[model samples]
Target: MNNVKVNVAQVRYREGESVCFDLVEDFSSFDLGTEILSFQAPVHVQLQVNNTSKVLLVHGKIDTKLNATCGLCLETFVYPLSLSFQDEWIFRAQATDDLLETALILDKDEIEINERIFEQIVLALPMKFICSAECQGLCPTCGANRNLAPCHCGENDIDPRLAALAKWQSKD
Candidate 1:
């Protein structure tokens, strides 16, 4: 879990004035509804917050390590992750349609960015995690990990559900 909140109360409401922050937050794990993510190290973040009097412009970079499971081999591996992000925070009273849809409407000067960071991290991950390009997945018949050793199972063993499809092909 990450609890990262930035306070902009002391920042001057000027165009060129900005506040810089360097933070390291400990993150254990988080549930993404579909999958769970575990962090191998603390999240390092560097942020520059600029107040434009109307909106707060935030630009930052995040770096961290993750313990991820390979989708093909189901083996756990350490994955290094680094990403950069930029966001706009507008006051609820000053929000307008002219601003981009990604702008965050804030009711207070204190902004919590943990959720946004998590969303970014999840979006940056690949659709399927493979340990390596040459990873050999589990054998369907014997349930053996093919990456470790070769399997001697018969290759023509058709699944019971697809037996009809095999017979249909043989008919041709």
Candidate 2:
């Protein structure tokens, strides 16, 4: 269910050879809210490998389409995800200073590349997912969806300040 290998042996980097491949990522198991939004990870791990310095420069943008409830209205709408980033990964850094520059270090046998790239995509996601800015959330009084229709209750409700006085009059 987790950590499925998305990119396997796609990134080919010799001591000095440049290689790039198309990356397509889909989320079959990624469930945002009881639905698979296909906004999981990189569809393809398209990379340009420089064999000379053992660096893989990645440049690509992905489209993530998912339905998010409107923050105000609570209505669901397709939220388009436009995420693009350029990553520089240097392998086998002989100099200690060059070590930190690498985004992620992997063993020779490790064929997983989703962790490094996936983090970037996640950061691109909106902090608070809403369908739109002007979404009128569910009505507070009758529990009606205000976006769909107007509530029967008046906006200016009965004045609670006069409730005690009304109670006194009712006793008479």
Candidate 3:
């Protein structure tokens, strides 16, 4: 049950005509993989489709809210994701290896864009998710969240390698 499909069978070729579509799809069924816990709301997609004699061009933006775990604190937080993509789809009689990496082969009159949109969302996800830029991660010694409160771990708990340097500087 894909929510995003654009029918291009009736589109005039090489006329430079364009069709626009806007949809709000329930993304609860789509698995966002391990990076996302759940979707906060329905995904919104805005697309413009154009057909040139041999190629169909689709360009649009996808907006959604994702529940992601913070990398440092391991806390779940809602992250807003917005992605824009432009893809050229070729109307091919047969598949060819020389096709562009980003280009998709059109096999049917209607193009299902749900998979492509999901791919874009996955690619746009950040390598590291953080609740805030100033998030103080858990303390190494006590394993307590530093952002919540300061730990009473000894300030003198310096690395053994650096401890030798500290003694030398104090002697001066």
Candidate 1 clashing pairs, residues 3+ apart or interchain: none
Candidate 3: regions farther than 4 A off: 12-14, 29-36, 94-97, 159-166, 169-172
Better of 1 and 3 by TM-score: 3
| lDDT, model 1, position 53 | 75
lDDT (Cα atoms) of all candidates against the true structure: 0.82, 0.57, 0.77
Clashing pairs in 3: none
lDDT score, candidate 2, position 133: 67
Candidate 1, residues 55-170, lDDT tens digits: the string is 78889899999888888878888889999999887777778887647687777878787877777788888887788889998888888889999898977677886998888899
What TM-score does each of the candidates earn?
0.76, 0.62, 0.81
Which residues of candidate 2, in runs, are more than 4 Å off?
A: 1-18, 30-54, 93-98, 109-111, 157-172
Lowest summed lDDT window (length 10), candidate 3: 28-37
Q: Pick the candidate with the highest lDDT.
A: 1
Q: Which lDDT tens digits does candidate 2 get at residues 7-74?
A: 32444445555555565666443554533444434344455544445455556555556556565665
lDDT of 3 by residue, 59-125 (tens): 9899999888888877788889898988777766633566555578777878887888877887888
